[model samples]
Target: MSDKETPEQRRERLRQEEIKNNIGGNLNDSINKSNNGNLVDLVGSLGWKGTGILIIVIILGYIIYSLFFS
Candidate 1:
């Protein structure tokens, strides 16, 4: 269909085009590509709340194992 686009749709289409045309605006050229990994990036990506929950789950698993199997 060749119907005229609304203003909002035109603005959104233009914004998408702008974003698509902008290359390497947030590219990290210095990042390591291998999976050897960095703990800081891993923990930071998870945020404090997620890290805390992970720690809690690990501690509970350890406690359960110690109480039941040892």
Candidate 2:
């Protein structure tokens, strides 16, 4: 593989490195903390439509795994 990076590649590498080195503040704050910290309502915060799509994708993944391995 070629080892040399273009200008864009160098800039992106530095940007990612900066993000990696910075770790402070409420970066650890949970997004699903509303609804009195209830797991069900936290997921519901994604909206009914988004939650449905997430469930469908998870089911599809399980189906694909079973088809190939079973």
Candidate 2, position 6, lDDT: 88
Which regions of candidate 1 fall more than 4 Å away from where they truly are?
A: 1-36
Report the Cα lDDT for residue 57, model 2: 86
lDDT of each: 0.54, 0.55
Report the lDDT of model 1 for residue 19. 40
For candidate 1, write residues 24-48 as lDDT tens digits: 3312311232145575654444445
Candidate 2, residues 23-70: lDDT per residue as tens digits? 221122223355246656445344444456668988999999999999
Worst 10 residues of 2 by lDDT: 23-32
The number of the candidate with the highest lDDT is 2
Residue 23 error, candidate 1, Å: 26
Q: Please name the candidate that would achieve the greatest TM-score relative to the true structure.
A: 1
Report clashes for each candidate as comma-separated counts.
Answer: 0, 0
lDDT of 1 at 53: 69
